[model samples]
Target: MRRTTFIESYGATCKNWTWSWSFVNKTQRFVIFGAWQEDSHHIAGRHLILDEHWATRIPKGSTKARRQPGYPQAIEHLSRVAEEGYALFTFPIWQASVGKTGAGRDPSSIGRFEPRLTPKTLVHEGGMWWAQDLSVVALHSEPDVQDDLADVGAPELGRDEGHSKPTGPGHYFPRDRKVREDVLKKSGEKCERKGCSEQLRYKSFLDVHHILGIAKSDRVTNCVALCPNCHRDAHYSPNKDALNKQLHAYARKRPSN
Candidate 1:
């Protein structure tokens, strides 16, 4: 993507005119920019760094060093993006200077990546939560389990005691693109609503609605393809519960093809 386009896109999602290390757009897709300072900082693995506001060296839970201004929001963003199986786009910058117009830009390695959720250490610690061990895998590939672990260092299991396993239910339910694509395909590129007559238009795609909740499963049985309008109705309409029931019933009746 062009620098101008990147700035405009990031600016729309973020208040700051300047681009930060990472920002998730309205659609929950993550835009991560690689930095020279992060490389110089020896941050261990190939991780998506966050803004400096979250880089407090003071350990987490320290009364003296409270959470930074954006720390809580950063953590929430990480959770939602990961849970929803959002795509993360990376742009590598060569120099430490953000002002340079054409910083050492690497084009070959630019690609969409998914976070390898199997990090041995907890994602949140020391007032930070960043995705570590990213691999350029196919978007439709299976969830988690990085294909390339040859270069990734083993989890520093004992390094940070405070970091614990991600707890609670529904922690890591990444939506499967394969299932979503299948649902869209089964819908024949048209909105699956009973009476709606929406067709897929140029440069437009249907949104896959999870009738049974994305946290439960990304299986085709639990999903339906709907246009933006119908999708909104499924979530926001006063009779959404009934609509969801109908969608789920339709999904079950459709062939697996």
Candidate 2:
């Protein structure tokens, strides 16, 4: 589909004729951005599974001209996606010469992008918002053409040093693998839930569930062993948060030794 059709399909209107971003559909609660494949704007590095799309590095929100008219709303939609765990869409765009319109960047393809909360991708620095780390999983064309790198025109963007693995959010702390192993082993190969009789023939049958998610420390006191049924309930149940709180309370009461 063409750029206008794609954006309009998502209940957004396109304003700029040459090139633009921020096709935000407030009602739909989603944002579709035009991602540039230019080397200066994107990093499709070999080391990272996700590609990084960056906004032009300019001071924002301080001066009237510095704030791109569409930026504030677009940023709002993107932030909502991140906080609410919604997907963001990106259409691959690049400069091309057309017979009547002359030369300009246009969206030729589309892709799915995952919103991340890492400082590099989403941040408010010096009282202004910065979008330097938009992450693209893969790009798809009309005929189901999937390009992992999204480096059709820019080859140098995949240089080894250009990209690295994505980091967690500020509150995210890495958990220790050894702590998980110890917690699982200490559970006696059985579900730790109170009054539950599930038993595991092998250690792998029990999952070492993190009571407060992996973002918190992976100490034995923060982890619990559960059978598949209990594990699923802890994650997918309607009262998952309540179940998590119960599990954490149990973990805290049990002896760490």
Top-TM-score structure, candidate number: 2
Question: Candidate 2's residue-wise lDDT over 1-257, tens digit each?
Answer: 46566667667654563334556666765556655555654433211111112222233233322223444445555555443333455555554444422122223222333232122232222222223343332121110111111212233444222224433331111235576567767777778887784887653556677665432334678778887567767766788778878888888877655
Question: Candidate 1 lDDT (Cα, whole model)?
Answer: 0.47
What is the per-residue lDDT of model 1 for residues 1-257, given as tens digits with 9 covering 90 to 100? Answer: 45545545554244332323344566545544343224543254434344334433343344454333343444444544433334444444444234332222221122333231132111233333334434322111121211111112222332123134334321332345577678768989889989995997732346677675442455788777777667667755788779888888888999753
> What C-alpha lDDT, on a 0 to 100 scale, does residue 8 get in candidate 2?
71
Q: CA lDDT of each candidate?
A: 0.47, 0.47
lDDT of 2: 0.47
User: Alpha-carbon error at 32 in model 2, in Å?
Assistant: 13
